[model samples]
Target: MGREAVIVGVGDLPLNGGRIVGGGSILQVQARAAKAALDDARIPMSDVDGLLVAGLWGVPGPGLLPSVTLGEYLGIHPRFADSTNIGGAAFEAHVAHAAMAIEMGYCDVALIVYGSNQKSERSRTLGGRPPILTMQFENVWGIPQPVGGYALAARRHMHEFGTTEEQLAEIAVATRGWAALNPAATMRDPITIDDVMNSTPISDPLKLLDCCLVTDGAGAIVMTTADNARAHGSTITHIRGYGEAHTHWSIGAMPDLARLTAAEMASRRAFEMAGITHDAIDLVECYDSFTITVLMTLEALGFCKPGEGGAFVSGQRTAPGGEFPMNTNGGGLSYCHPGMYGIFLLIEAVRQLRGEAGARQVQNVETALVHGTGGTLSSGATVILANN
Candidate 1:
């Protein structure tokens, strides 16, 4: 009964002006999203026997007991519960954890969810961290929080490779192109590389358009045995392969400024487990905390040789009608990025595999690559999904 783990349902809320349309606390919206995912699978909430959740909603008590609090709020006691937080990559890692739990006969149906009210609550800030161990080294420099870290990577990549600012802009412009087709995306207006170049510079070569959207968003995914999903006649995406790794919490500790070693290692392991080649991949959905994030990830994931991402992403290759389709849901760059963006990446991959993405749907999609990066290029998780 537990031969394979497949995702049968996913739910992501709408966004207006890059923020959730309705205001609600993190748990409230997360609960609704959970209900929506369960309903989509034609499974009642009572059927959920496992839960995997991650969030920044609770600080002290609930934060420490994230899964416990979510369980209490949902009014369900699960036989299997996990609250593994690896930053934005946490949700992708959760998928792997749930797959093992389901296959091990610990839980039949598992739910993974994420919700954030940062935008609505105006709680988005890099200023709250207490200056301690790692902070002791970084906090004093006054380097711009996450953006500065990513900018360092971008600058190093440029120095190592012949990558150009125009090449980096191509990612932003292409992502926006897909966002234009996505009604749920916050920034839908068409943008050009020139527009990106002209936008206010945030950190060195990174511009205002290079950063991700700050929005309040919630999403959920439901996974279960393949037999269970087939019995319910639910279209499903196979959780064929997954792997996660992290190298550094702070930028100073990153192994190489020119490359994301964690992404390379994680994707290599996932690809080995799936036995899939680069040509077999139909779509790529990776984290886009910044335009550089996407560019660097593509290179790290072996889609192209290292130091070749800028060239790989140029010419709108990742946009619609291009040879490579990526961030079809606009990604965190244009889509709603509620702190942790990995959950939405999973949902979009499922939707695309199910052929549910109306306009942005790719033809003959059988395999999709979903990757997430958390912290300041601190962690990476890769999941390979198949609709076979």
Candidate 2:
């Protein structure tokens, strides 16, 4: 929090389609995203001393080899590089890690990148287990997929706190409204409360619409010291504060199904470090892998009381130009989800702070809060960005 890390540049490849329009495999999309980010920041690739990449889906290869491979493709021989593979939370934590590295003068500019091709090619079926044989005996029998896992948590929220399925539907309906404004959104059908309610149930309480999209896309963001922002000739969105925390990896290990302890810790630390209250935050970008996930994050982040996320997103509060204005990019719900939806959260947040979003831009978006949770609600990271 002392030495600030500001975003010098941000960019992402088209979040729709995969290996179709010149973007082949996850590696190709990652390179495209990184180049776009460097270009957006107006910084040369040679200037980047540090690189952070996320392990991607598809392109059958070594698990944690993409980061170094990407650096080679970009011709960037960085001193410090990492390929953190903490599920979707990698991108969010990458920002915090880069900020710390820059604060300590470990590197000048760090590029956080993630890309995936879950749609075009994958061995795992829609509701099938991983190709690995071990998962059959250890996991799949317990839960069909992540949707059911999150659905169990959602049902617990409803049972304990009187949360209605309609409330969960509200978040989906509102995010779709924002997606309607985004031309790049995959499913812009303009759904309604009834539409969400009537959709085929994926799990008991969670309907098909309640889940996020599984498209293929990539996103990247560049971070450096505050001085680097000025040197790059880009509008600065300084990283005033950031926080990260992690819980158990699996759902059974979670202390509470309804509450996300990692998000709670990250949100509290982020607000305290930023020296601002929740109301001071003009916008929020929360990782919404599922409707329940968004609701849990809102509650844990103090945007709304515990068990009130369903009611909190009611009446388009998250839609464009709404009072709260959460996830304006249509989010993973309607926007291009790809695999790592976390990176898009930062992209939308930075765009709003820079006033780059055309119709979706909020008025005087000076401060924004972004939270990304990885694993099965296993990890949480938060960042407070301000134009100052």
Candidate 3:
């Protein structure tokens, strides 16, 4: 048998919308989250010999931040650590890397963590310009912020295969249904197809509600070898398969907006690793920074054929108690979007596998597929998780 890495524990801070947290800085939040995860696994902090931290985008200085800062704060230093920033895919990649480290005998226990202050930061303003290093030429020509970029992709899908505005609205409506069950969700009011249709328009085809929530949050995941998982009495959710790929960072350079190449490649590799097909997956946590994101990912992952996402999501297909359960934690659309949207996908996936989600839980979620996209649909990372 090949070397294996398992997620032993997971924890997340409450997603608060009204007020932002200022006392706890990024490092403090991350430390707290990491500690919580370790506690959940019933392991002491001193047992961690490896640490992986998600990179921060808004930091103005040297850019990259390693696990050292949080390590020093938490008083648990590890010899092996990685601080990676591939856009929003950082956390998912960290989890995968932790698995590889344990498999290679480089470490016994690892902590994967992320934290952000998107709400308190002024740079998050809609009119605020991204840093020079973060800016893309595509946005210079009034391409309409992130909303416009995704809207353009959605419009192309409509023109090519009769995809309709109503179809896109279906994603928003269904996600809101999930949000109603999550008290942490920012938008809890039930919405209808008409509500999404008549809502204020941000871009040509995208409405205001079509976008994800803006909030501040932190999350952490604990990884260890299979043997360590069992020895430590941790709730084990094995990483059966995972894949990552990227095309271009800019939307203008994309050959086809409707089809996501990186997502397809990553999903294919992940499915092969897990030795399972789409039918075996009881839950799916597809990143949804925007409504179109979920639609594009659904098609890319073979959940539906190209151009069939809009129709596939209709009739509450992805809603609670639906045929194909998805985004049960309300997702980025209604749950929270703290710039690191991909990290939330990882959080929700682990929560489902642990059967910790009470009201929004799905039945028999023994296996799950999580896909993350970063930048302007530039990078993709897919992880297949199984419990049993």
Highest-TM-score candidate = 1
lDDT of residue 64 for candidate 1: 79
User: How does residue 256 of candidate 3 score in lDDT?
Assistant: 92
**Cα lDDT of all candidates, in order?**
0.91, 0.81, 0.81
Model 3 spans with C-alpha error above 4 angstroms: 18-23, 123-136
Q: Across residues 89-176, which tens digit of lDDT does each residue of candidate 1 receive?
A: 9999999999999999899999998999899899876556667988788878887888899999999989999788999999999999
Each candidate's root-mean-square deviation in Å? 1.1, 2.3, 2.1
Task: Give residue 237's lDDT in candidate 1 (0 to 100).
Answer: 86
Q: Tell me how far the alpha carbon of residue 24 in candidate 1 is from the true structure, in angstroms, after superposition.
A: 1.2
Give the CA lDDT, 0 to 100, for residue 150 in model 1: 93
Q: Estimate each model's TM-score.
A: 0.98, 0.94, 0.94
Please give, for residues 15-96, the per-residue lDDT of candidate 2 as tens digits. Answer: 4543325647667777788889989998888899999987655336554477677888788888778777666767777888
Candidate 3, clashing residue pairs?
A: none
Rank the models by TM-score, top first.
Answer: 1, 3, 2
Off by over 4 Å in 2: 1-3, 16-20, 58-60, 122-142
In angstroms, what RMSD does candidate 2 have relative to the true structure? 2.3
Q: Residue-wise lDDT of candidate 3 within 1-388, one digit each (tens)?
A: 6557898888777756622344366667777778788899888899999988765533564334557666777788797798876667767777778888889989888988887766755336543456365465654677666677788888888888888888888888889899898887877889998998898988888898888877777888888877878888888897989988888766776669888888998899988888888899899998888888889999999999998888899898988778988888888888888777787788788888888887898878899999998766777899989888
